[model samples]
Structure formats: C-alpha cells, structure tokens
Target chain A: MEIEIERNLVMPGDVVPCPTGSMPGYGTYQNEVGEIVSNVMGYPAMYNRLVCVNSLRGCYIGETGNVVIGRISQVGNKRWKVDIGASQEAALQLSSIDLPTGEHRIRSEEDQLHMREYFNHNDLLSAEVQSKSQEGKAINLQTRSSKFGKLKNGMLVVVSPNLVARMRQHFCQLNNEVDIIFGRNGWIWVYYNNTNELEVPLIRRQQIVRISCLLKLMNKALVMISPEKIQQVFERTSDIELEDLLAESTLERIKDIDAVE
Target chain B: MTEEILFYGFRQDGRRPGELRQIKIKLGVVDNSSGSALFQIGHTSVLAFIHGPKQTKHEKESGHIHCYFNTAYFSSSGERRKFSKGDKKSNEFEANVRTMFESVVLMENNPHSDIDIHVLVLADDGSVECAAINAITLSLIHAGVPLKDFLVSCSSGFYSGMPLIDLTYSESTSFQVISEYRVAVLGKSLQIAYLNYDDIGGHKLTPEVVREITAMAIEGCKQVHFIMKQELQNACSN
Candidate 1:
C-alpha cells in the first residue's frame, strides 16, 4: 500500500485529533516512513504543520550564534570582519581576540589596527553570528570561548540555500557534531573531525550538497537524487570510507591529485 | 453555437459567473510565525504568515517596521517548483499584495520597525492575487498587528464581452480580450491599486466596462471583509 506524508508541515510526536471528518488514525503514522496509517485522508492544506520524517526532512544551514567556519575578509580599527555566509559580515572585535598580552588591553581607535597582522583577507577562520537582520543582514562574530574561532583543518561544501536552512535547524535540535556554516548566498562550510585537515572541507562540501540535494528531491520530488553518485564523492576523501565499486587505480589517481592540491 | 460559450448561465462548478467559490479559513497554523493562517478558496490553497512588527536594528534595516511579502510555489501538482526570479506576473502579484497591506497597516505606528508577510502556496487553482491579499490580511489580523481597518481585495477579469466576478481555473485561462482589476477596500474608500488589461477586441473598451468590473470586484471584497470581521469577533468573544 502507498502512503504519503504532507510537506512543510511539522507534525509532533503526539497523536493528532482527527479533523471533523477525518478517519481515526488515518492521517497518523504507525511506522518509520510516517505513512498515514489511515487510507482516508484530507487534502493537505497549506500552513498545515506536518510530522517530521527523517528521509523527507531537508538539511540545515548555519545561523546567528551558530559556530561557523568563516573566512577573514576585512579588518578595521575596532574589529575584524569574518564572512560566515550570512548576508552581513560577522565582526571579530579586538576585544573578542585572546591576544598573547597576558594582560587584557583596552580597545581604542588611536591604536594601530593593521588588517594583515591580526587577520589577513582570505584566512578561513571560525566565528558565530552576533545578530541577524532583515533582508539577510547579520553582524560579525567572535569566538570568545576556547572551542570557537578559526577552522584550521576541514573541508567546505556548497549546495542550494534551502537545504542549508533545513539542515541547520535539524542540527540545532539533534545536537550533532557536524558544524555547518551557511553562506547567506549558496555555499555551506562544515567542520567534522577538524584533525583530518584537507579532507574535511571537501567532505563537508560534497556531503552537504549531496544530502541537501537528495532531501530536496525526495521531499518535493522536484528532482531525483542519486545517493550512489553522492556516496562516490567521499571515495576521494578517504579510502576507508570508500565503496568497493571504485577501482584501486581510481583511488590511486585521486590520491595523486590530493597530494598536489 | 460559436466557441464563445456563455458561462453566465452556468459555471464549471455550476455556480454563476459572478459567484465566488467556498472559502475556508483557519488561523495560527505555524508556531514560528507571529501570526499565520491557511486559506482555501475552492481548490486553491495558500498559507500566509506574519512575523514581526517589532523593533528593527540598523542592519536589520531601520528601527521601523517594513513589510515583506514572499510567495513561493512549493508544490504544484506532482512537480516540485524551482524558485524562479519571480516572473513579471509574480512580481506584480507581490507588489499588489504589498500595496494592499500598506493601506490597512498603520506603518507610521511603528516607525523604524518592520512586519514580514510570507505566503507559501501548497496548491494553485486560480485568482492567486485575491487569495494572497485575503491571506495576508488574515495573517495580519492573526498576528494582531495594529491596523487602521481591514483591507480586503478581489479581482475581476473580462472574458469575451462578459466581465466575470472571479475567474476559475478554466475561465481564467488566457482570453483574447481580457482586463484584470485589483482593488483594495479600506473603510468607505476604494483604491484601484492595480489594473492590467489587453484590448484584443476591435473596440476602445470604455471606462464603463472598467467601472462595472471594479464594482463587482468591490462587492467581492465586501463579502470577504464581512468574513474577516466575523472571525475577529469570534476570536475576541472566545
């Protein structure tokens, strides 16, 4: 039997009261697919909150206060701006930086603030959103805590914007290790197992895009997502994670490319 | 009989051309939205949400409230919709929705603050503009954003020589001689915010046709206004 779950609506774990004419248990899910157990169903209405299905749910994007892998773009007298992918540039205040001075120094405009000495442009750093504004605007961020700031070794991936938003929400709720930074435009930066260095950025990018594209296709049926093709991208990142289908020669060829990069 | 069959005697749904389909409305469907509602006018189903009327920071743009209308065709039939740059017609619909809300919403009340209205379409049948206008207004009410009065809107299209009150999926299809009227009604004042037309017939369609269509459209607005007021009253009473 075929079963369908409504889109965009958030359904809670609690049982829903059947609508006036709706059959009891007809719209509720009994199994993992969240298929409406009841055959009689009402036309899914707009604004209808749906139950969350793991497969149909889209990926999340990074948000304000979200720890993100940001690239240092520009530095100024009082602060340095980091690009966290939100519309506005996230600031890394002079005060936010844990300088080696042992003694905390006060910030003043008169103090010489060179952009390069502090953070040069194109430096892939990490920060969080200080604030969010309308029309995709946001404030610069800083990593005051020990764990935050500057993603030294990781990979970044990009996908459509909607996918990032979905994934971000999910991560926040589930408390997962995948730290995702959603560029307000279209790219996503993820840092998983920061020790892996070169592999993480590429892995995050490929994984995010693949997962997002797949969720979108499954949910909207707007397109078909090839999970096999997505899994293939990981083969180049690590041999241990690769599937058996890829030839040893192909793996060796990818390793040579990785070595050069 | 010529191909120009008269729908005046009967509609596809067996209603008169001047008649509106059934309207079902429910408020507060989204938890994240300050105010939200689901509206179904015949087969067309739309969801509208209102977020904010709160203070807007500089980066958030002005301390005052600004209104934003987002219309997305999420699921149309079995096809998943890609976000287009909002073609001309869609842009016009967005603009009209903005204007209609601007009239009723007391913008000056919350200077430097902004209100956001987002409409997501689950299905599309016909008369999208009217439905969006109605949905946004209801969302505002649901959100409890202060307003001078209820601003309701409706559209009437000219097909052949007859002016239909509200076009259905089939009748609303491209007509040779067609004019679309979108008007916002606030209190006793009626504002013709948008009027689009193509003069296909070999005649300079007089203002009389426009006036007639406007009158019919206003009548539809009044009907919608009544329903909105009743909903507000019910909510207050409860």
Candidate 2:
C-alpha cells in the first residue's frame, strides 16, 4: 500500500482544506455551519476520516505510556506535584511509585508522611505517564519500574516538546558513554552513568556536555531530534571542538534533517 | 490653525487618504516569554509579550486574561511625564484591550490557567492601541495560543470633510479631526470585535460618514493581516 503525506500551513480562523464530511480532530473545531476550521497555527493533516493540525509551537500535551522528566515542585498529602513544563503539574501518588529498596509492598501511612524523603522538592526524575485525572487536567505519573527514579549527576536541557519524536525506546545509551532520556515534555536529561557520579572520567564528561549542546543547537534550528539524528551529528562533527559545537557554522552544517520536514 | 494638514490631496507625511503608515513586525524578540512581538507603524511602536497559561493562585473553569498597558516615559516626544502604574487612562485602555482579546481567544480550551498580555508602548506618535493590538495578536500567534481569529485593529478619522485612515498624532490632535474612530475586528471575517470613536470637530454623526470610515478601518486591518501572514510564512520557511 502506498502512503500519502500532504501538509499545508494554516492559522487560526483559516478554513481547513478537507472533504466536507470529514470530522475535525485536535487543533481544530467545527463551526456552527459545520465547516471545519483550525484554531491553531500549524500544518493540517488527514488521518483516515479525521483531520488534525500539528501546531508548530504548542506546549506539550500529555499521553498515556509516554515518558517524561520532571522536577519535584511540591510534596502534598499522598501525592507529589511535579513540574513537567505542562499546563498543570503532574501528580505522583504515593501508591504508584516503587520504594528505593525495590520491594513491592503496600504503601503504608508512614509513606504519606515521609513523601519528601522519596522525592523532595527540586529533585529531578523520570517516569511514565500512567493516566490523566478524572475531574481535572493533571496527569498521573508512575515510577513502578527500576528504570524510573531520581535522576542525579545529569543536567536537563529543554526544547520545544514537539521536536522530540515519539519512539519505542526513549531511554538510550549513546556511544556507551552517556544515558539520555528524551522526555516528551521537552526535558532532556543526560548523565555519564548512574553508578559513578562522584568521580568521572574527563572524556566522558566532555561527551555528555557535548550531547546537551547538540540538542540545544538542533532546537535553535527547529529540527526534530531523535537518536538516529544524534548519532549522525556525533559522527559528523568529530573535528569540531566541544565549545564550538553550537556555533552558527556548526548548526548550519548538521541541519540535514531526516525526521522533521 | 491655518497649517495645511493636507497639501495636494496628500497628508503631511505624503501618504494619501487611505494609505497606512509603513508597518514592520518582528517576532520572538523576548526569549523568555512564550510569545513576543514588536510592531512599528510610522514612528509609533509597541512591544507585546504573552507569558502564560501558567499556573495561577486560583484555578477556574476557564483561563483568565490579564493585560498590563505601560507607556514608557520616553515613548512620546515632548512629553516627559512619568506614567505611573495606576494612571486612570492607562488602566481604562488596558481594560479595553483585555476585553478585546478575551472575546477573540478560546479561553475555554485553557482551563485553570492565566494568559497575561503585557503591552509596552516603546514609541508613541499615534494610535498606540492599534499598534498594541496588532503586536499582541502576533505575539499570541507566536505563542501558539488558540484563537477564534486574528484580531487586527486600526484607527481612522475624518480630516477637513474627507475621511482618512490610519491617522497620525498630528492628524488626530493637531489637524482638528472632524471625527476619529478606532476599531478592532476579526480580520478574516471582518466581524467587528470592538469599536470606539469621538468626533470633536462638531461634525454631525451621519450614517454615511460611519459607513465610509468603518470600511476604511476594516480595509486597513485586512492589509495588516496580509502583511503579518506573509512575514510569518517567510520567517518560518527558511
């Protein structure tokens, strides 16, 4: 079967170029006259009978099973509020997280009082979106797996959330040197290694910093970021110094975009 | 009072009756704000910044719109007065702008948040509100805030029995406008969103004058929207 891809820029109040019977999807609304109109500025696309506009600069909207990186903003009763750069702070219920010892047991009353010890304010962590709240727009996050927990010795870099493509595996090891988590909320965390944070090799540290810089450079150029693009940029920019990685010349050269058209 | 406001069917600045001042728009000037734009028309300039949908102290069923209108002390020539934050004129103008955008933005979509629009008049020759409205519209687009339509605004007035569009400071005040009107509209549909005017030259408010001036203002807004759309497309294409 052949696939078709057609995209045209449309802003708010612009009528969508869709068949008269198609239903409107995200980033669009049907008027009283039943004509589909775009409510955001973006590229309108058709999927089956639904038409949606992929907005250019919109903030991240949540989805189930997606990974996110966030900082603990507040500790409340039976829950922790996290700043994931979304419309509302996500909630991590006391019962949804795994204890530090990897033991799978019921969360007792003590856990509610000692919530700060598990994830205090300003502590960064990675988790998967479990669900959205019933009455509100808040997202519910879970850290049931060993892979999701407090992130240390890693620096966070934020870009446009849409630039981070959805992939099967968000956690990846780059060149066997650094661990990268591409959060759907545009927060990227890169660390050398989970076990060895107190002492680090000089070369590994430079590589980790370089990856963060490259992510920022791609963001400035409005290019989509994926692991394949990262590896491609890494292999191509071998001659450039770490400090010069984000220079205008370097950004212009590595912009052979593969994913974002 | 014998100064010739119009010489040879041209305004003092050499623009014809229907002609608008040269417009220049620049987006994303403020890195921190979600959206920001600077709009310049003739010598009048306004900078607008959109900050949120951010968490506020109180959450509601719909988002709240806040407008802060500030005129920099140096914005207007020959006026060295400090525009205090609570100036009654500024407060009224700010409320009018806020209400203008509240009708255009899709507030129901952004539940439990605050969208703050801060408009700064960097230079004032005439029609700062029109420039501010244009700047805020561009800023909202840049921020990707959902809107019903682009809210484009323009000011016009009657000069010596002949109607003029996009009146300058001198044309509005010095030339003794027979009538002056400011309008904000949904550009694509030409639906009037807000309207206010004053006729100080003692000209009778006739239906003919109203129709003619309104058509002129709508035309001005359409021209502005066209220019903005073109610039935005070109800016992102490369």
The CA root-mean-square deviation of candidate 2, after full C-alpha superposition on the true structure, stands at 2.4
- How many clashing residue pairs appear in each of the predictions shown? 38, 0
lDDT of 2 at B26: 91
lDDT of 1: 0.52
Tens digits of per-residue lDDT, candidate 1, B193-227, equal 45555332344567887777888888888787777
**Model 2, span A10-117: residue lDDT tens:** 888998888767898888888878988898888888888888887888667789998999999888889998888877778899999999877888888987888888
Candidate 1: where are CA atoms >4 Å away? A1-261, B1-8, B59-81, B159-161, B174-177, B191-204, B235-238
lDDT by residue (tens digit), candidate 1, A26-107: 1234324333221111122212333212211111223566545667766666777665443245667777765533356775
* Index of the highest-TM-score prediction: 2
Candidate 2 lDDT, B1-238, residue by residue in tens: 5567788999999999999999998988998888899999999999999988676655445567899988899988655778746898689878888788888888767677788999999998888888989999999998988888899999988766787889887777653675458898897888998888865566676798888889889999899889888887876666
i-RMSD values for every candidate model:
15.3, 1.1
